[model samples]
Target: MRAITFVPGKQGTLGITDVPEPEPGAGDLLVQGLALGICGTDRELISGEYGWPREDPMILGHESLGRVLQVPEGSAYSPGDLVVGVVRRPDPEPCGACARGEFDMCRNGEYTERGIKERDGYGSERWTVEAAYAVKLDPGLGTLGVLVEPASVVAKAWEHIERIGSRAWFEPRTVLVTGAGPIGLLAALLAHQRGLEVHVLDRAADGLKPALVADLGATYHAASDLKAVGFKPDIILECTGAGPLVFDAMLNTAAAGIVCLAGVSSGGRLLSADAGQINRDIVLENDVVFGTVNANLRHYRAAADALSQADAAWLERLITRRLPLDRAPEAFDRGQDVKVVIELGE
Candidate 1:
């Protein structure tokens, strides 16, 4: 089978190569790979900036969509079902969080993730996943189901946001989503689904991004400064790891507001921030700033539900480009696209 492989920490090692076909163990599902979504994490892995160091090249895709080719008897899924494999698996020690099926919040940082960490990912012509970790999607989703994985991340973020907001009388009416990328757009989608007034901020002054946000019945601001957003947002989903923008979001939210940090920032850059004022604002306003990454089964399921209920046309627009497996490496090139997907099947 042809698969996208990369040697972790080795720059210029990403390519298409032949690998043994996946063999499913008991209680596993053999799936025919359909599509693979490319994100910043994939680019980091290809650039040798992130991922566990391994001598041999490992398959390199986590955002996956496929149709089940075979399933164990009595499995909840069946052959021909559309499914997406969960990325993170429980750690060996199974930390308190992982033991509770919250490996996304692995306390010891020992958890293994498919297509990441020490395990082989699903960026192949075919793949196998334990039935428990395979999320069955609506057949109607087709290739768009590749979005479940990223959506799951924001689902977990919203889940945590609500949990924190529950401490007070939380009826948030306005939300500001920083960055108009996949995560930010999906974050806005989920917020819109909840009936919140959504506003998205990005650097692009004119592009499909601003148009997409407008189609959602939400407002879009194409400005680097958050001050242009005008009113203080009741909730802020900061999807751009830009240092200055992150701090701007912290101080720009309404009183008792919650800010969800869902973007991973590349280090080595320093900024002079007013720590005292930032701390004072949070303490005085009782605001919360939290970071979330990855997703467990619960979030994946929530993501599937959200995708299923979303406007199909809108969801389709998120995928701006699709390439064949042989051209998978090209998908990593940064472009003015919301999502880039690699088609694994002919």
Candidate 2:
């Protein structure tokens, strides 16, 4: 078997090498990946900025689709079943936030990221996972199965948006997605399906060109003058890691509007913001800003179903490129598309 392994050493030295194949035992499973998606976190992990607490050689793929080659009996999973699942788990002495099912805030961070901490990752010829932790994907769904994990994050955030605005969530209002990247585009796609007029704001033209060509039912704008457009978004989903976008999005939201933070920054550098701006200009100004992270399996279900009604007209136009696993590093470095899927074993 072959897998991408990261050892304790200088970053970028992680490599694919032959490894022992895994077999299902106890409550575990063996999966054969069809397609896996890479996110910005992979870069952070390779660079050791994501704080994975891992020093030994470890496998590195997370967002992936695989068939259950073997599974413990009586588990929801079965051999030959397709599935998608997260690597995070609840810590026994987890913080209040995580005890309530928020795995991101678990006090014991090591217990929070399973694939990175304890288990092997998906970027391998064979992968093993706790059968109870996986979500069974209907094989009939095809490649869309690989999208469940990422799209689920958007679905969870949407649940938050609906709660904040109630009936006004989609009433002829504008919405802005700060980055226009894959996550940003997923949010745009979701917002568009809910009948809200969506627009994307980005500083770069590299990825937006394909989005425009796809007619994703979205309008694109430069981030510099969002207010000049004279339409304040009722809700903003900030996918840009830059802090200025959050400040600007708060400033440009309508009364009772909400801003959800979807980007992750690992440097621990705080973004400067006006103490009074969020209080006076946002809260006092009636704008709400919140942060979001990974999703549990429920969101995965919604994301898979979203593909059915989401402008199927845009599918081919939306897939920028599909590259083999060996080229995953180059794709991350170049960031050449809206959504890049890593082709795994056929």
Candidate 3:
């Protein structure tokens, strides 16, 4: 089998490599890879900035869609089912949260994240996962199903937003998503589907990002003048790791607002900020700002439903390019496309 892999902490080490095909164990599903979605995290991993691979030649993918080739007896899924493998696995010594199957909220820093930490990922022709971690997808999704893992991140963020917003008398009607990347765009999709007034902020004004935002019937801002959007947004989902925008999103949200930071920032870029005023705003307005990453099984299921309900044509536009396994490295290039996918197998 051919797989995209990288040696963690080594710059310029990512590429394709031959690896043995995995066999399904009892209670496992052997899935033939169909597509893999690329993102900033993959770039960071290739540049030796974000991942913690336990060994050399670690398979480099987490966002994936596959079709089952084999399934264990008594499983809910059958062979030929389209599925997505969940990325995080609990630690050997499970933390309180992991013990409750909330590995996404692991208190201990010992969890293994597929493609990002410790374990091998799904960037291969085939891989095997425990049946419990495989999420079934709608067959109608086809290549569009590749977006589900990233969509799950959006799903979990909204789940937490609604959960935290319930702390007060909350009825949010407007949302601002900072960054028009896959995560941010998907976040906008969910917000629009919920009938909230959605506004997307990105640096691009006339390219694919803005067009996709418009296709969603949501507002697009170049992020040059966020204040020009008129009123403060009731909810803000920050998917850009740029330091200034992170703080700006927090400072500009509405009263009683909830801000979700879903982007991981690479440090060393400095920006002057008024921590005192930020504190004052949160304190006075009872605002909530939280960071979310990865996802649980429930989030994957929610993401599948969200993708199914989305306008198929609108969802298709978000996919900018699709390449094969040998050209997997190309997916990492930061092009104008909203999403890049590696089509691995039939």
The most accurate candidate by TM-score is 1
What tens-digit string does per-residue lDDT give for candidate 3 at 1-346? 8999899988889889999989788999999999999988889889987766445689989998999998888999998999999999999999999999999999988999888888889999999999999899999988788999999999999999999988878899999998998999999999998999999988886878888899899999985546757779999999987788788877788888999999999888778999999999988988888999999999999999999999999999888898988888888887677888999998
Report clash pairs, candidate 3: none
lDDT score of model 3?
A: 0.90
**Candidate achieving higher TM-score, 1 or 3:** 1
For candidate 2, lDDT tens digit of each residue in 1-346?
7777775333875677777887767998888877877777776677766544546777777787888888777877768898876767777677676677667546656465544555567877778778767878666667767777778889889987887767454453778888777788788889888888888877765454535624876788764546644688778898876766767777888788888999875455777777675678775656678888777666767787786566554654455778776775565665556667777778
Task: Give the runs in model 1 whose Cα sits over 4 Å from its true position.
Answer: none
**TM-score of candidate 1 on Cα atoms, chains taken together:** 0.99
Better of 2 and 3 by TM-score: 3
RMSD of 3: 1.2
TM-score of 2: 0.87
TM-score for each predicted model, relative to the true structure: 0.99, 0.87, 0.97
Q: In candidate 2, which residue pairs get closer than 3 Å at backbone N, Cα or C atoms, i.e. clash?
A: none
- Model 2 misses residue 302 by how many Å? 1.7
Model 2 segments beyond 4 Å from truth? 94-110, 166-172, 206-214, 266-273, 311-313
Candidate 2 yields a Cα-based lDDT of: 0.73
**Candidate 3 segments whose C-alpha is farther than 4 A from its true place:** 53-55
